[model samples]
Target: MSDDAPVKADLDEIRGLLSVMPKADEAARDAARAREGQLTKPPGALGRLETLAEWVATWQGRTPPRIERPRVAVFAGNHGVAYKGVSAYPIAVTAQMVANFQAGGAAVNQLCAANDAELRVYEMALDHPTADFTDGPAMTEEECATAMAYGMMAVEEGIDILCLGEMGIGNSTSAAALAHALFGGKAQDWTGPGTGVTGSTMELKIQVVDEAVTRHLPEMTDSFDALRRLGGHELAAIAGAILAARVGRVPVILDGYACTAAASILYRADPHALDHCIVGHLSAEPSHRRLCEAIGKQPLLDFGMRLGEGSGAAVALGIVKSAVACHSGMATFAEAGVSDKD
Candidate 1:
C-alpha cells in the first residue's frame, strides 16, 4: 500500500470523529451552577470564575472538572512565504526555535514547567518549507491531511487538557491569508507584525498576504482547501489536534493568533469544536481579537500576550486549575453551616 493510503485513512477517521463530537453536557453544567449557588460565598460573588467552573464542568461532562495531565503540543514548521521576507525573522529561526523547545530552553518550556504541564514539540519539516501560497498551494491535499493526522496522534492517553501552539516564521502571513479567506476580509485587516516587524517590512508582509489571498481566494472552497492552499504544516496539525481533543472529550486551551487561526479551521469545520476550547489569552497581534470573536471565545487572560509556543495557554492553565480547585474544594452552605440569604 502507498504511504498516502494510511494518511488518507487517518484523515477519514478524523472526519468521522468530528461528526460525532458530543455536545457539552448541559446536565453537568446545571449541577455545577447549583453547587456554586450552594457554596458559602455570596451569590454571584465569585463572578466569572463561577461561570468558568461551570463551563469546564459542562465540557468535561462532569460536575467537578479536573485538569489532570495537561499537555501542550507545539507544532513547528517552515513556510515558503518566509523567503519573501514577510517576517522579521529568517526561516532558519523556525528550526532553531524547535531546537530550543526540545532543549527545554524556550519560554514555553519554562512556562510548561511552571504550570506542571508536559511539553511536546513536533518538528514538521521546518527544513523543507511549504510552497509559497502566492504562487501555488502551500501543500498537497494529501500532505496537509497527513500533517493533520500527525497532530491528531499527539493526544495520548490520560491527557485531560490539551494546549495548542505553533512555531513557524512567516506563519503570520499564512495566518493572514487564512483569515482573509475564512472571514472574507481585507488582507490588511488580518495582517500583523509578527516578531516585531514594522514600517516597510510590515508593508511587505501585508502585500504578501494580499497576493496570497488573491491567488488562492478563487479556489478556497472550504476550510480544508484554505488550509491546503495557505496554511503551514504546523497550523494544519494544530487543527487536527483540536479535533482529536474534542473527540476525546478533552478540553482544549488555545494560544495566540497563529494557534487560533489553526483552531478557527476546526471551528469552521465543526462549530461544536469550540465547545471544548478555552481561549488562553488575547494576543497583542492586531487580528487576534477578531479571530477570538470569530470563534466566539472570550480569552481567559488579556495580558497582551503574543508569544506563541503555548506560553499564554500554559500560563492560563493556572487559572483553569484554580477554577477546578474552587469547584471541587469549596464548601457548600450545608457543609459549612452558613446561613442562607433571605
Candidate 2:
C-alpha cells in the first residue's frame, strides 16, 4: 500500500520495515475523544464501545471513521507436521474446508454474510505443505517470504478493515510452537486440545512442539527467523496481511489463537508492530488467554471460541460497526438540545 507498493516483500524487506512502521494517528484519536465528550450520552456509559470508536478513528486516520468495506481473509494451508498425527483431523480437510468456504458453507462465510463483510479464502499452496519442523525449518526464507508477499496481496484496495483468520491441520500445534519459541515457555504451557485431541494425542502434540522449538531455539536469531523455522504458509500470510493493513491505514481484527500467534511474530519483532490491531475474541485453546495476556491485548469478546476460519473476527466486526454507527451517527448534546453536564 502506502507501505511503498506492498505487493512485494522478501523476508529481509519485512524485517527492514519493522523499524519504520507508522503509528496510529494521534490527531484522529484526539478528535474521536473530543466528539465522544460532546455526544448526548452520559460520560463513560458506552465503556469499551467509546474506546473502540477512537481506535477505529486512530487507525483509520479520520475522526468520522467508518467500516464500509470490511473484509475477512481466511488463509488455508496444509501442515507437513500433520503427517505425524498432531491434530485429530486429517490434512485433507484443510482443502475441503477451503472449498466449503468458496461454496459459502463454512461458519466464516455465514458470519461474513451476516456482518455485511466480504470474505476471501486463500489456499496457500495446499498441494505442497512445508517440510516438518522436526526435520528442519518449516519453510526456506524464500518460500516464507513469498507466502508473506502473497498475504500482502490479499488486502484489496478501499477495504476499511481487515479480519484475519486461518485453516490448516496441525496449525494450532504450529501456533503453540511459535508461542513457545517466541515467548520462552514449556511446550505444554502453550499447547492445547486443538481440533479436540485427547490424552495421548495431546501429549504427542506437546512433545512435537517441544522438539521443534528446541531444535530451532539456537537458530532463531530473530522473530523472522523463528517464523521461518516454525510458522506455516498460512501463518506467514496472516503476518503479511496484518503488516499490509497497518500500512494501508486499515484497522484489523484477529480471530482466535492461530491468527493472533501469527501476528505475534510482528509484535515480537517490533513492540509497536500491532498498534492497529485488536483481538476479536478470547480463544478457548488455553494458550490463547496466556498469549493475549503476554501481548497485553484485551479481546473484545469471550464466547469461548476456538473455531478459527475467521468466524470470531467476523462477529466482532458487528461491534465495530455499532461503535462506528453510535460515534458518527449520534447527535451531539448541542444538536439534541440537551443540557450539558455541570
Highest TM-score against the true fold, candidate = 2
| Regions of candidate 2 where Cα sits further than 4 Å from its true position | 1-9
In model 1, the Cα lDDT at residue 208 comes to 89
Candidate 1, 91: how far from true, in Å? Answer: 1.0
Residue-wise C-alpha lDDT for candidate 2, range 1-342, written one tens digit per residue: 111223445789877777667787999999999999999999999999999999999999998899899999999878899999999999999989988999989998889989999998888888888899999999999888878888888888899999999999999999999999999979999999999999999999999999999999997889888889999999999998998888888999999999999999998988789889999999999999999988879999999888999999999999999999999999999999999989
In candidate 1, stretches whose alpha carbon ends up further than 4 angstroms from where it belongs are 1-13
RMSD of 1: 2.4
Q: lDDT (CA) for every model shown? A: 0.85, 0.91
Evaluate model 2: give its lDDT: 0.91
lDDT of candidate 1 over 15-48, digit per residue (tens):
6676787888889999998898898889889777
Q: Pick by lDDT: which candidate is best?
A: 2
Clashing pairs in 2: 1-6
- Whole-model alpha-carbon lDDT for candidate 1: 0.85
Inter-residue clash pairs, candidate 1: none
